[model samples]
Target chain A: MENVRVIARMDIKGPNLVKGIHLEGLRVLGKPEDFARYYYENGADELFYQDVVASLYERNSLHDIVSRTAKDSFIPLTVGGGIRSIDDIREVLRAGADKVCINTAAIRNPEFIRDAANKFGSSTIVVAIEAIRQPDGKYMAFVDNGREHTGVEVISWARRVEELGAGEIVITSVDREGTGKGYDIALTRSIARAVGVPVIAHGGPGKKEHFTDVLLEGKADAIAVASMIHYDLIAQQQSDMENRSEGNVSFLKSGRSSFGEIAPAGLIAIKQYLKESNIPCRN
Target chain B: MSGKKIAIIDYKLGNLFSVRQACVYLGYDAVVTSEKDEVMKADFAILPGVGAFGDAMNNLEKLDLISPIKDYIRAGRPFMGVCLGLQLLFTESDEFGSHKGLNLIEGTVKKFPPKKTNDEVLKVPQIEWNNIWERADRRWESTPLGSCRSGDYMYFVHSFFVQPQSPDVVLSVTTYGETTYCSSVLQGNLFACQFHPEKSGHHGVGIYKNWLTNYSNNK
Candidate 1:
């Protein structure tokens, strides 16, 4: 379908892939390269890398990771985090990322969005909005890892970003992150309704159902998910055992004591079964 | 005419490399330049960018190449603008506030209105690949763009649009959200596209090839 685009997000907090709750506390899950390959092989349309490190790090390791993945994977990739200048954006793009997502830098200097878009073309510039629920039940934008709040409303910012030449806006819900509950459908729908540009909804997607819900109900053009897939709690399950392994055999004629075991013996039986069934089973 | 050069105006904004790369892929020797002499001396010129209308106009003015560019186009040299370059041809743009454009074309740039709840919720900066409808004019029909049918999909990425004072200038149209917008327009030797043909892959390359072929032959 023309409107369906799936993006897999890899949130990093050092060298490890991390999942967090409401964009605050994070838990390391596994290596990012493994997860990136898994997503790439499993029908992900695009991939995104966001380094959650402090701005003082002076270096972003995500660029190398994205570059390495792009070399092997045939899909578009985007990198975001600590992108404060045009030079930073250029560095990431040069490293083989198809697009660069800017947030705090864009808010601090609105003109930067226009400049980057002009230099790289709108297709390569993405505006990421971290939205948190406010006291009055309205969603407010947060910058700098969701530490500082901006009075700018989510929908308004989405509109402004597009006007400034941002080709796409990735709206992430800080409140629903890592909860495995589901995406904030209302927020995603509102932002999707606000802009004529494509909107990518991120955060709080726990299962395949959540993805369907957001795309069908929330009207999000694309949905970015990380946690559930990283933990292996969700994915398609396949069975490889055949009828030959259903029974056990007892050898009592040669031995004084009866010995029993699962019928299909050794690696040969398993390999033959797998080969005949044409199921992908790895050890 | 066989060895004519095409200059792509690069003012520290716009995808100069991609434009140059596209030209190279189409078997044309194109250079990205901000120099007036080079731009004016070229057989054809291309003004390509993806930014706010106001900032682009400012850069053109700052470089002191505006008058020279106008003179070159007036001399009947083929000129084309992509995205913001297309918007730059308008008289004014209402981004952040009302800002003046190059006034090369009689038109105004305005943002897409906010989508109401009951509406289909058209996103701003209408993006994605959409169909392009060709103009009925035989002159436009004779160019490489003439090969495109009424519903050929080209890539688009913009929120604001230009409304030409004269309908005779419009060469193509595209639909977005709830509105049907102008996608391309041409007047004399000048042509502007709201979509990025350079990034549109094969179709984009075809457009560039057609332009180069036509420009070289006409010269």
Candidate 2:
């Protein structure tokens, strides 16, 4: 049996790690590398960094951060957003990202997927499907972080991209983003079933059981965790270190659980829960 | 040739940096080169490749690397291959179309069975974390996977898998669908794995360490 990969999805805005409701209202968390290093060292099978403003600004600015993190981390790194051309993909890869995930550029130029896959190999390319449900009774692929509607149904788009040579498909739920209610299991299940490539389920996981459900019931090859782990863990670690030296203020102090349980700590907990539930995780 | 440098062969179709960085992470001095002399002369040569078999073989020919690589292997130096690099060691591959390989080992690569025996779908380009169990034997005890026992997960992404002629050369096997195919092989100084050990986290880096630690300069 294959083991499920656990990924940490971190949003980057300028130099700080940011969090927003459904990819909106950006708020800086900390340094991108700081969160990336913490996640990789803890048990993150892979890391997903999407620059929230990359497409808006028309430039992928996470190059330096990716290069620095690549030197320190050994796990697979994926960079997405604002990548408009094959040259942009090369630049990201040269910056030490193992794989490039594209959304807007891919929808704008579907042929770009085949071209990139042909040039860089399928494994280096990932098609990120930002899906949101509509009144027409179908999930449509959204671009620019759920800002633009491509009008392509999620399942059919997934199949089309796979045929076009996408090595993997990342299915993110716009409706579930940052809500922490649980995964959009129905959405994940459909796309996972539709595509031959591995599907990574992203957005909305507030509980430990969601990981098991999305993997087993939804049949996702990997699950990306964000809101739940990022702030809590970083704050907790910061509080511990701060309370140790100065006995006061910390960056993650408002996170409440600081000085108690760190972010990476949840990784071990969820991993253990998954194992106990008979789900094979990387040992 | 004299130094402890590890040469990573680049034929314009592989992730050379990540592999080199893995070795560098383990404190091994690694270099990426497509030059015939440098590759043949390195203390240890790591043939790391990605993409289709036909394209890779064609690129090797264009670079005039076919003979140099064969000559290097014949010299009995330690050589290890990753992914497509491993497949190119075979006599032939049926990916996209029939293609000729380096014929360093006796084998032909084939696509995975589209469906399992029980009617369950077997995904092509298996892009997931899979456990490569060691084939029961003593030969595997010497390869990079020596540290890994059965059921330890490693990352794998491929549409086709290599099938060797003789089971004697097979070092490890991974089950996909109802069939079990040869995943890793060890033929004296020649070693290769279907999965990317460089991206398999600690277990992956440990493989490089094991192979390097035991690799000698006798030749």
Best by lDDT: 2
Interface DockQ of each model: 0.15, 0.59
User: Could you tell me how far off, in angstroms, the CA of residue A14 lies in candidate 2 after the best superposition?
Assistant: 1.7
Tens digit per residue, CA lDDT, model 1, B1-219: 246688999876644555666676566678889999999888779998766666777888899878988898788878998888888888899987889888889989988875744655565656555677875653446665755667765666678888999988888887665667788988888888998776554566678778777767665
Clashing pairs in 1: A118-B14, A195-B123, A195-B124, A196-B123, A196-B124, A197-B123, A197-B124, B125-B158
Provide the lDDT at A131 for model 1. 94
Enumerate residue pairs that collide in model 2: A233-A262, A233-A263
Stretches off by above 4 angstroms in model 1 are A1-57, A61-78, A90-99, A103-125, A129-168, A173-187, A190-198, A203-212, A224-283, B1-4, B92-100, B116-121, B135-142, B217-219
TM-score of chain A of 2: 0.94
- Show where candidate 2 strays beyond 4 Å: A242-251, A257-265, B1-3, B217-219
Candidate 2 structure quality by residue, lDDT tens digits, A1-283 = 4568888899998888987777787767778898888877778888889998899879889999999988868788999978989889889988899899988888888999999999999989999999998987689999888988887898999999999999999999988887777789999999988877789999888778888889988989899988777766765677677768765654456655432222233676778888999998775
lDDT at A248, model 1: 30
Candidate 1 B-chain TM-score: 0.93
